[model samples]
Target: MTSLTRAEIGALGEQLAVEHLRTLGLVVLDRNWRCRYGELDVIAADDATRTAVFVEVKTRTSDRFGGVQQAVTPDKVRRLRRLAGLWLAGQDKGWAAVRIDVIGVRIGRQRTPEITHLQAVV
Candidate 1:
């Protein structure tokens, strides 16, 4: 088997996160939406709540630095909130609610990948 590069692993993690969201009945709006600030890993609408969700995905090969979720610091949360507002401002449709989410993906050798989703991060 071949080892994956950091970018490749991150892409895979985002893909997996999208799949997980779809399974939860959320419709994906965009992926890797970027602007001058930064990138939004995933944007999805939750039909049940008529809410827009801005997702930040963090991927890790190991917990050497910390868990993937730990990467999303207070500063990162602030950035994501700003990006979410930017996204909403550019959209024509108004959402009843908007929130931020974080998806952490951990990949390990010879094991299935682990995924954790935290909603309303900010």
Candidate 2:
């Protein structure tokens, strides 16, 4: 059997994250939202609160070096911000109250899925 490629694995992780977020009451509005600078893995809404989320998903097979959240570098965050601006430009919606979140997912056998959510990413 062929092992999953990095992109494939990342996709799985993103899928899991979306499902998990849904379970927590976040309504997913978009996936793989992108622009010239970077991409946001997911965009979700809390309808009652009228808040939109720009999410960045990071996945890893292990924490041999560090967990998945460790991958979100300052540069990466900046790129996400840039892409988010471009994304918002196409919208009629206001983003002043929108939220940015980073989700870290680490996968391994026998370990419950590790998920960390960082809201208001900065």
Using all chains and alpha carbons, the TM-scores for the candidates as numbered come to 0.95, 0.86
Angstrom error at residue 89, model 1: 0.4
Global Cα lDDT for candidate 1: 0.89
- The best candidate by TM-score is 1
lDDT of 1 at 59: 83
Among residues 3 or more apart in sequence or in different chains, the pairs in candidate 2 whose N, CA or C atoms overlap within 3 Å are none
Please provide, for model 2 over 1-122, each residue's C-alpha lDDT reduced to its tens digit, 9 standing for 90 to 100. Answer: 46889898899889989988898899998898766666779988877677878898888886775764677788888877778778778888764467778888877643676788888877
Number of the predicted model whose lDDT against the real structure is largest: 1
lDDT of 1 by residue, 1-122 (tens): 69988889999999989998999899999999999999999999998889999989888787787875688899999999899999999999989999898888888843887888998976
Question: What is the Cα-based lDDT of residue 37 in candidate 1?
Answer: 95
> Lowest lDDT 10-mer window, candidate 1?
104-113
